[model samples]
Target chain A: MTDDSIGAFRDELIDSGLVIDAGVEGLYGRTLAYEEIVSGIIALTTRTGAGDGAMAVHFPPLIPRWLLERTDYLKSFPDLTGSVHTFGGDDKRHARLLALVDGGHDWVEVLEPAEVVLRPAACHPVYPLCTGGPLPTQGRRFEVQGWCFRHEPSADPARMLCFRMHEFVYVGDPDGAGAHSELWLKRGAEMFESMGLDVDVVVANDPFFGRAGKFLAANQLDDALKLEFVSPVSSTETRTAIGSVNRHQDHFGLTFGIESADGEVAHSACFAVGVDRTALALLKRHGLDPGRWPAEVRARLWP
Target chain B: MEEEIRQILEEHGRLPVPMADLDNNADLYEAGMTSHASVNVMLALEDGFDFEFPESMLRKSTFESVSAIEAALTSLVGTPVE
Candidate 1:
């Protein structure tokens, strides 16, 4: 598929006020795109809430190291987490460094290790909370927007050092988990369909662990745990995975000991939507046309 | 170059700010810049310079003022912008 459309759509996003101007090199890096996308989801979620009790959740900007530690996040993907650290020094030392730099010295500090790592994924905390408490009824679900951080130096504006991740997490009986994923995969399709974009729902893979990631890449043809609702971004990277339905098997349930009222092992699943990516995808698919946009789609998104 | 950066920040709601406010030595954060303002400033820097602001540079001290951000950016790009 020629992605001339995605590039046009990207330009349209900047026009729609969904994206601030792409920086110096333009689309390659240093652009801002958030306002339009957030409002778009707000409109979509409101539509979903008309018949559902899906409460919106607000989480902290950063998650704790302990929260990520239990999940073996570092083991799974150490490359992404960002940590905060400070140099161990008295005011005098700090003053001295400041003095040198004031005198045109190359002032630098080695600093201590980071105390807290930034949250890379939106669902890390949700699963832990599920584990601590009893599994409620068979069909409880929740949704939230998490501000995430990544330590990538790619300098791609399409990629961000920090980004907002929207996730609808379903945890409860095993069957309920399946139901949530099934419903969202369809729901996500509907959202894209409404936007007049060509969308594909494909079984996709996560950035798996270690040397295994290379192994998984070779079989890019296979891998069932991933279901990505993909739209084209660049011709080279067509699958802009806006959302994914993940079956955590029993990994989270086992770790958190979350159980059904009847004490059966609970299951866990999540639908993660890169809200920013979705806006970008819309830009790629729909050329920034307020007048040309379907009234119903505009009403659903803008109103 | 600094004037252009300041003008961009001012237009983007880096309020209580004047065209002449962010001198080369003022500590913008200590002078009471808000986090939201910091983000806006970061956005402007990105657009103006075609640079990405790393999380490592999000500290209160980094946006201390025009000079601070310039220093941070200098280290990042490894040169002074004349």
Candidate 2:
């Protein structure tokens, strides 16, 4: 869609009280109506994955800086990662910081890099926690939900700087990890379809940066490592990726020294949905009011 | 070009088997080169050849084997492989 149309749609949403204007691109507040839809999508995931022996895991939006450094995410997506900063200084520096702020000068340079970074993905912290030991013989499955931060500010509402992701992470042998991703690939699509959303599972890759990143993205696509469930949240001509199934292929296991029951490096995969994006897609499809949405779709969520 | 490519692979490919045992048509990924190793190999190749790979050539097919790397380099340099 054209920029004007996208902006018009966003204005309609704001004017209708679905999304609150935060005065920042890619960062907005959601009204209760929007949050209710987000909750409904999360409920669908919880209910559908109940029979899969998944354990619920939750984390704050901040993760250790050391762990983020260990991952190759920085190498591939340096442009999109967010690192936290804080005022770690003596009283003299503190006074200077306040004076700069009072004088309308640059105060951010006085802040130091903090030990924590904004969590880039919901599943990142889980890998290191499972290290230093062998996983269960059959493997481990976790249902994790948290706010993920990516520093790509854009005019597109679908591309938020901070968003919620409800993810199912699996770690174990190659076959188990592969089976988990495959199972979710079907189940995830089915859940969205039942909720009256158009679902298309397509082979996809991360938006890697630079020339070398092109090769990495190509290799990822060549291996079919990432698959996304895209729907028309913004424009039908360019559907937004509301969810994804990704295969880590022992990258995290090798990085964190995680081992399987057989003493080999474990493989990992995750099925994750962008809860906020899904909510927007639902709003686009079913209309603004949940009470007026189709009965079958409401039944799928309310049930 | 072929020998240089093989040397770069041996240093950066992280393959389980020796590069000498593999044929020019052998798939390096199947020979145990991980995706991380591929990035290193690509960087090493750029430094060794003194030429940057174009975005179009940044693909698995371009670096799948020794012959493929040689062909890609030949095209980028616009000269016959030595």
Candidate 3:
């Protein structure tokens, strides 16, 4: 059985007659998936700094180890961090690794795809920086659009291993925490609704405790993972979680000892908009017919 | 204390454990307890008690088991465990 989402996007790509990766195999699909996802991320990031004076920052796709360590990333998500490693030996070892890359798969596992592990979630990169900087007396907030990686071996294209994460952060605000989350939630709804996806708000939980996540999953529930916007795709409740209004609830703030004007520690929240799947959901929602949908929306995205 | 921890585990989908016999030096990591689950437990603890779990107390040994969590909660609440 195929998910209606991947099926819908696949069909639309076929109908559009765009080049789908001709020789691709398995669930990753063809060219259209890549084009649609990359293009979708491009379109979303281009819309920021619109009237809110939002400054954008794009960090390295592979975050440094020290940075993740400071935020106790391993403690919270050891299961997710990808560690960068290599053969620890003399220059001969280094040469062997290089030979593999140049010789096209030779020299054994010498270059052992060591990692400065690919970032699992995008927000961890931002937290330590916020801690190091001079934050707002009230709180400093910024939005970043990042490409994140996960070890999801699931074949679902929607659950692709490499996906784009669009997350906005409201940091440093101690007393104004609730106000920030509320504002982001309102902004997120307008964006998803405008994209023409039938959106539904849900309270979700993080995928940390595999079994403990049952409450969120039993009825399609997630833990304190307060999810507000899910758009209908195949039928109804099976809609994708295109966007999440996350209240990191000062988890980051508390981790870093981020403080308000008086120097009292503050908490912060994040609103993550999963840009890639959201675009897929939008395409599914609008029938992937460019002509049938409003040209202005398309023009804004394409333009 | 063991019963309280069991209730949290049962209600929260966390792994149940026998923490009464578990001492401070006991190896919690080898006992099926994980730091990832500890965060969930922390969140559950917050919701269960309507109080905040300070990040200051999030050290490795803090969430060793049911007894440890109860001790932390007891300290935060300024009272002995029932």
How many residue pairs of model 1 clash at the backbone? 5
Alpha-carbon runs more than 4 Å astray in model 1 = A1-34, A96-109, A212-223, A235-237, A289-292, B1-82
**Cα lDDT for residue B54, model 3?**
62
Q: What ranking emerges by lDDT with the best candidate at the front?
A: 2, 1, 3
lDDT per residue (tens digit) for residues B1-82 in model 2: 7888899999999776899999999998777777877888999988987989888888888888888888888888767645
Candidate 1: what is its chain A TM-score?
0.79
Which digits, one per residue and each the tens of the lDDT, describe model 3 over residues A96-121? 77877897885556645443667777
Better of 1 and 2 by TM-score: 2
Q: Which TM-score value belongs to model 3?
A: 0.65
* Reference-based lDDT, residue A187, model 2: 93
In order, the interface RMSDs are 17.5, 1.2, 11.9
Candidate 1 lDDT over A129-206, as tens digits, reads: 666556668545677777787666432334656667887777788788788778878887887677665678988755
Per-prediction tally of clashes: 5, 0, 21
| DockQ, all models | 0.01, 0.68, 0.06
Off by over 4 Å in 3: A1-49, A72-79, A87-109, A112-115, A209-225, A233-237, A289-292, A299-303, B1-82
Considering summed lDDT, which 10 consecutive residues are worst modelled in model 2 chain A? A3-12
Q: Candidate 3: what lDDT?
A: 0.60
RMSD for each of the candidates: 21.6, 2.4, 9.7
